[model samples]
Target: METISIQWSLVLFTALTGIAGWTFVCVAADEFLGRAKAAAFPAGIAAFVLAVVGGLASVTHLSHPDRIMGALGHPTSGIFTEAVLVGLLCVFVAVYLVMLKRGASDGARKVVAVIGAVFGVLISFMAGESYMMSSRPAWDTLLLPLGYMLTAMPGGVACYLVVVAAKAKDAQVGEYAKALLVAGVLAAIGAVAFAAAAGQADGAALGCVVAAAVLAGVVPAVCGALLPKKPQQLMALAAGSLACAAVGIVCYRCLMWMVSEPVANLFLNIL
Candidate 1:
């Protein structure tokens, strides 16, 4: 039997960073929009911790500090671009969190929030773009990056929901539910684009993609919708949404690897 393998570090890095960094985006929305102002500080801290943890996981495969520095020097490399973007995301988030703690003016924190949101989006796209290569035809597509950005939103936003929903009013919870539904739609588009790109993907891989959309996308949206009705079940619903996001993300990434195909050996084909 062929042992299917993947870049485990890359997978973890992409999923974790996407989720954690995006969580910051949601936290920023709460602060900027004044939906959950009080929750912003605590939620921001959660996002920072998770983002840092994910950043550390990405370093596991780097092996040496020199190799990391070398990669950073090459702006042409996708790894370099992704690393820079994620780093900026962490920096902005840290600044925003500190400003919140220091009781800085909203203008300062808002500036950081806007900057961090931009980085969050860029890093999400780059997470998948870094995987694209001429050698791997299956990995090269605009849709892959879009999928990375979109599917990640559900999980990332779900993290914020987990932290903020308890004190959030019914109307506020409804707004979050609406956001989840939108994320679900985006997930559908991105995940389907992923399946469409894999011309030779097996049924198993396709099935997993469908499952991912539901777990990472549909289930969370549904939970958010129900949360307004079940006001007392805040923690349970929020956690379930986050859990689904994590599992769905892993499932999607794993199936993506299973369907990967290198371009046919051109030299051998010509023989």
Candidate 2:
């Protein structure tokens, strides 16, 4: 049996990027739907910074970080697609921020937000697709990558709500509460579906995946339903939701290795 040895760098990359990407989409929702604009600028900055850090962590996994951009030359590779998507995410975020600073039209900003939201969401999917392999039964499915993307949304919504509550007084977040609940349910369904796809080969792997599903899905759903109106309490709920999402994401990474040999180690051997 292969041991469960998760890659810390990849963990950080996936978790951070997932959160960042989802947060951006939430922020974009605020822009497109015309919600609380007070936290929009700072929230966008937070998402952008988180993504940059996650991108850096992703490169750390490679022996030749300096040549990482060469990935773009191999368009057929999932990794190459992921790299390009992340780049597009950064570019979109930067342009959106710049337009905000220069007082661009609402229509123009919404256009940027629409584009940014698409790239932001897709990066997580590509990240999971990059890791897909036939050797690992758990990894060889669309559900895993879809789980990666769906599971990330609750975290993103929580992070965005945190900023909204923290930065604004008496912030109105009833609509956001609904978003959190929806994200949580989707996350739960996705996680469990992925685990089910694995066909119960091991106790530990199934345990991790199932537990992650509950944590990532149930907590946010409950919190969102009972979301406090007070700013501080709302912040607390949001923080807790984000933490649960993080734990779920990291556990999924552990599940990847628990079910099969360390794929990263295989690459390292080749190098």
Candidate 3:
């Protein structure tokens, strides 16, 4: 397999986006449950800030960062459209945090919760399309978006479960942990199916598939299953699995960048 320099910017952006999205979802969950802890505020703030930074880094990867606003103005540009949606979602999250700090009424918080869920789904879809829209055979799949959403949900829940586990003596962290584990497993399965369906028969492509399978499938399953025994260990496991998933994503992107369409009849002429 030929090694290429991975785009560190994309990697950073994707990783941070995963973490930030998880944070935002956790905060939303806390609000939904009527939790008024100060820790929720800090998590929400961090998530909002990180999400904005991640979105900004994504723009910097474009050839025309200055034209980003114009890209958003274009109706046909899916990438730009997604970027705008994510930006809006981040703004909403920030505003939601502000309202929480100000002791917003239940009715007002509920309104924000509804909006957050909508934007959360939108952001998840856009994140999936970030890879799925690529010409690379390895990434262009309907399952990509669903898998991204699944993976993100667990991460978000895991973060929330951790905080709740620490603070609430009577809280059932096991339920959240179990939910996260299940989501991770489903995402891993979807990712594996996508890789199998799209992978080339060549050595490089085969190597990529094997690497992705180990990282995205096997590792996560084993680690996720161990969550019930040790909560702290489970947290570490979740983090490790998430990291592996991120690496698999990067590798998948690299493979897509490297692979090219097979030329017809050229081999016949050579023969």
Candidate whose lDDT is highest: 2
Model 2 off-target regions past 4 Å?
228-232, 261-265, 269-271
TM-score of each: 0.89, 0.92, 0.75
**Residues 1-271 of candidate 1: C-alpha lDDT, one tens digit per residue:** 1214666777788888888778888877766577777678777777778777777777775657446676578789776787888788889988888888899998888888988988887887788887766776677777777888888888987888888865453426666767876886777667877878866556777677887788887888787778778867777888898898888887777766767754443212111
Whole-model Cα lDDT of every candidate shown, in order: 0.76, 0.81, 0.60
Give candidate 1's error at residue 45 in angstroms.
Answer: 1.2
Q: Write the per-residue lDDT of candidate 2 for residues 37-78, one digit (tens) a residue.
A: 888888889889989999899888777777776755778987
> What is candidate 1's local distance difference test score?
0.76
Q: Which candidate is the best by TM-score?
A: 2
Q: Give lDDT: candidate 1, residue 75.
A: 86
lDDT of 3 by residue, 149-264 (tens): 65555545555544554454354345555656675576566556655666552576656555555565556556657766765564466567666755654544444434435323
Cα RMSD for candidates in order = 4.5, 2.2, 6.3
> Can you list the residue pairs that collide in candidate 3?
none
